[model samples]
Target chain A: MSELTGLTLKAALEGLAAKRFSSEEITTAHLAAIDASSALNAYVVGTPEKALEMARASDARRASGQAGPLDGAPLGIKDLFCTEGVESTAGSMILRGFKPAYESTVTSQLWRDGAVMLGKLNMDEFAMGSSNETSAWGPVVNPWRQQGRNADLTPGGSSGGSAAAVAAELCLAATATDTGGSIRQPAAFTGTVGIKPTYGRCSRWGIVAFASSLDQAGPMARSVEDTAILLRSMAGHDPKDSTSIDAEVPDFASFCGRSVKGLRVGIPREYRVDGMPAEIDALWEQGIAWLKDAGCEIVDVTLPHTKYALPAYYIIAPAEASSNLARYDGMRYGLRVEGDNLTDTYEKSRAQGFGAEVKRRILIGTYVLSAGYYDAYYLKALKVRRRIADNFDQAWQTCDALLTPTAPSAAFALGDKSDDPLAMYLNDIFTVTVNLAGLPGMSVPAGLDAQGLPLGLQLIGRNLDEGTLFSLGSALEKAADFRARPAKWW
Target chain B: MAIDAATVRKVAKLARIAEPESRIEPLANELNGIISWIEQLNEVDTDGVEPMTTSVAMGLPMRDDVVTDGGDPAKVLGNAPRAEKSFFVVPKVVE
Candidate 1:
């Protein structure tokens, strides 16, 4: 790998500004790294030609002293975001060969800030699975493996490709989406930093929707500062998405070095679930001690509805997914299979288009929303959703932010939990409550597990209060000082 | 809320997915497992809680009833599976 590929997003920006390296050099290096690392299956499509063109333009702009904040930075976009004229498949066969005509609001913002797109990263089909095994292209392989084991492990999903690419130094950073732990869990699995901003912090226009009410876009990078820098460029209000909050985007980079003194961090008791690994518990204790040593107060807070979050999410997300996916019928765009009648055509197209997991979710969704079951399943889940949010709302009175584990365990081998849907859903137990409550949550790489894989600590902040999480995240990053990188096997 | 093969077939028809006769029983069993797992939500006491349709409490934003930026038919039909001129081609509905 080229040394330029190893530079952090922050370092790359400084290098571009200082004239130490031209934007073309950095872009070429990352493109080459991506080409060499194809075995990892991180990128679904590689845009080397477009990247070079963008790099040249960024260099010229820098020569004229008009460089944007992310000028010359090479980044990977998740396939979930629709890139204008690029084949944006949300990692499903249904959207195979469909090239979107318009750009997503999030990717357009990154380009406007002068970032170069290396390619579209892989993900779970429509951001549904906890592991990337659900992707049509293929599951992404984690760069890290156990000490003596050669079995391939998942990088986590639905942002698995983003996590793998960043961990393998294929890109400086990658854009990821989190409907429910999609961003944070993958980041934890890959030893990267990911933040799912408070609901509507970033516009959802043009991004593929999994669950409209729960979906949000965020960034994944190697460090807290890099994530903050990318997030500042990615977040803002857009009139196109009605759910977007018309709030001012803060300068997130400035909060990276801010003090955490006098801050009250909450430790939610419900996260300590049965059968959790010992290393995860120890890491949580270590995180608490780290915060306490940094002059912050730690308090035990209770989120009574946390246990019900997973069940509620499974209900609400699939219900919304069934509705959102209804647009993929064979007529307008994408794969089409003709049948004897229009309804048969719809059935054949969908049957051939979706994977098993997606089909299952759609079936569950249709069942729940069916006339006789709507009130019993869908409405009841909504009520539980309200209680989950209320628990978090009440916690804010006692603490500035809540701390917990990012996932139940470290990244497991591919196909380990694919057989059992409920076992797979349990992967998001610690992270889903934050999404249900519509708060900003982040995962910072904290320590390594007994098997030598990475473990992360999560911080849940109040709505529209991502600044506090950034401060606390950087503090934890400093204390953890986790510098281990996966050996180059790809 | 145990989903049986009959209910699974009903849902597959409603969802418009071509599930084979052989897959129905297995699909029903899998869905039943998930449904049983989610049935745990009924244990919670939600007496007067309002169903949350959205996370943020904001009214839907409306715009003036005027055309804004979509007129060309070629661009709209660019990705269509089958299109002639400005119209999408589908199987004949009226026979």
Candidate 2:
């Protein structure tokens, strides 16, 4: 595990290509590592047999001189992505014993690119909660410790397992979906890199819908280059996913070493929220200084609608979720109940299968979308969402990208905010606005909290401008010098 | 801001979930707390802002409104609790 940590994705692939180590060996090591790190609870289901089979095929392809860029690399699939012949639960019991006959375009594309499948990782049930604690499977523990703090803390969510896996070197990279900060939040918590590309940049054909309007899948990895390597393989249009963009993807790797000199970075004045921890503030200041050192100009900008984003997101996300989830009517790919009547079966199946938090969200979603309440709740939230996007539009005029803290603070204790939904929702405030605006965003570890847990700074780019975001993120990662290894590993 | 037990029960029914009356009070309290917090949005004035339905602004594609999909009814009903050949098996409705 120690040897696996800090190895760049490109280097690892090259090592495999050169036969310095076989893909089978790497896959075996990762499988053993996952077994050893069972206490972390990073995985929901591990498919070592399938991983070895994939690795053997990859090695065979390489021997035949036909290998892809991500050849032989082991990657974890987030439970949210549907894999043909594998159970895709989205972390809910409702989908227990359910198996999809089709693979998500993204998952299959990765397979075509020669990456080995590690297993399905854990997540928040139906991608609803900010902390993985809401998962029917259980919470994922952060591998990093908070100084003398002996108790385990959350790895963040709903893509916590993906982040934790990459951070602990359980896998080189993992697929993660972001509706409102699922990818970036978990990355920040685990001190790794996570990117949420522009909306529609990646296909969502077979990914389970949480909030269809906002959900987008992206890469999580140990370094910016690893993210670029994986993103190139994952991005592009698919006719199966009508929402996926058909635009040509720029060579993202080429931008990694390109100078950030003369780039304009915007600092949103409204992001300096009340009660923000001093450590987070100081880390943000340091990030701004790094941009300044890179010969970039900084200007103050205002997103006046910043405070309204959380409420708007809460309403819109749930409203969409309710509509999308209606497909799972106990007669489809999920739960089914035994009852004397049709309506009773539907009622009983849903009641017995869904967890408390998931049902609460469905209720909230339904309430906001009810016949009499649509205008006041759902429509009004949509209005605010636009204003928030407009705020970004105004700021982009003065800057190429916007800079802020990824979260208010670093990862908190697992049960710290478990009792308070509002407090948990606040953790996503800084990251959600970018999603609402349809822009690209990335999280880079900046420094450590007072208790030594890692803090991260986020960078937001213009829509479809992932190349710029990764370039800036890579440069910042190199300059920040805030490397903190996980406190424990399998 | 305090939602009563009856309101919680009513909302659950509207949402199509069945819950016992005993659990309604706690659900109501939690719902009240969350809704009251969301009420903080009332302080902001968005008088003229247009609602944003999707982050990417584009018109949804419309089809010809003709019937197009129907196949493998048996496969579709395979996961149902009870199905007979190609149709979902619901209790008989008429006497």
Candidate 3:
């Protein structure tokens, strides 16, 4: 039972296919693990009954030889994706107890593939903050503690809960979204593998909106192969999402372990920001060495506008968020805090329902998009976004993919950077560039930092070129052989 | 271009998020800190660059303007915080 929950998604699927273990057994094991994982605050809601029901249906499918690609696999859904009968919170108090009448397209596809929903994982409220502290349910504790210390660390955000759950084996794998570094940064922090596929790779119809142009759904798992497998099942062209790329979903898992000989892996010189830990820089150097050893040629590339990505992201994301979030006006769904008038009701509800960080972003977004400041902040940021994308376009002429350290440093203790918002925004420094460029970016656990916490290496790929990232990431994964797990204290 | 507490108050109102008297100043300070930091974008000369509205290569696909879905008002009102007769109940706006 203990070992059953430890199987990766690929292994679990094969195990189910071979009838080595029924999904009900695996689901039961994971449900028990989730019950014991409350200390980590990984999941905001548990659907044990629903999980069992889905597992039994999966088992019946397998028995009938009608299994799908991900048949009989149990996975955790991020709170942001609405599940038909399950409450999807998006990690905000305002969305409490609001169950969707329909399932998100991505999740509906997962169910179509016979994936089981263990529960909704926590996240930064409305996917805003870099640290999970902004979650209305309270901050999710990083499953990894610094060696021989009792202090808690953040698993990074806004996919913090998904990373922690995957790291702690609370689920086989999880579905996560990225707007600006949400998936990759959290995956880097927790030593899991996560990929934010190319902008149009997956349908965004039902995942709660953050920054529409930047938001994408992807997979987080324990291994490069597992992440690839999950991404294959998670991605496809959807008519519902107008921006969704009308393309075939590649068999991503097959790309893992493929040769990368003569592949140009670019190392962006602009990523070497000041004050980054030496170990992180060293890990990046080691990553380059590993790729070179894997029959790949390393090339230096420059994303000149890289430094502007974070600021640009903060502006554009909040601007879109302000407009996207305007729908929550004490009306159709979720929490409602009444005031004397209709407008007052909206103000009071949003003020009371939203957490501090969310309110902060809303105000920033509002102010930027306001009458006078639109050109100064929002439009300026958009133009910077163009330059940033152009920089990537220039880099692609020289290299097939780019490599850098996933986060500036390993997971920091919660509350360390939360007080200072600018300090907190800096956490996405290494990962934000990928989002701004609307490209696929992935984080693979490559090594551990000095304190023995896991560190990750990021891989950036061109538009619709996630298969190459999977291949390169697998090479890094194989070279590093990062198999360390956080000590099971929870 | 740093904003003051009064600006924050007005912005919050614009955002339809009420800011309490005590919290307004702190929110202002936080917003100013972020805004000032963001002012660095000015250093990048984007004189001729067009704002990137999207990264997807294609324009949004056009579909017939037909009602492909909806009509189950009960389903629409299912998640409403307050509902009556398939209508979402809210504070009265009209006199």
Instruction: Provide backbone clash counts, one per model.
Output: 0, 3, 0
Candidate 1, A2-41: lDDT as tens digits: 8899999999999999999999999999988898897899
Please give the DockQ score of every candidate, comma-separated. Answer: 0.93, 0.53, 0.90
Which numbered prediction scores highest in DockQ against the true structure? 1
Tens digits of per-residue lDDT, candidate 2, A280-358, equal 8888999999889988899899999898888888888887887787777676557776666766666677777888888
Which candidate leads in TM-score? Answer: 1
Q: List the residue pairs that clash in candidate 2.
A: A382-B51, A382-B52, A383-B51
Of the true contacts between chains A and B, what fraction does model 1 have? Answer: 0.92
The C-alpha stretches of model 1 lying farther than 4 A from their native spots are none
Give the CAPRI rating of model 3. high
Top lDDT hit: 1
In terms of lDDT, model 3 sits at 0.92
Model 1 per-residue lDDT at A341: 96
TM-score of chain A of each: 0.99, 0.98, 0.99
Error of 2 at B18 (Å): 1.2
Candidate 1 DockQ, CA atoms: 0.93
**What is the per-residue lDDT of model 3 for residues A371-457, given as tens digits with 9 covering 90 to 100?**
999999999999999999999999999999999999988999998998888888898898888888889999999999879999999
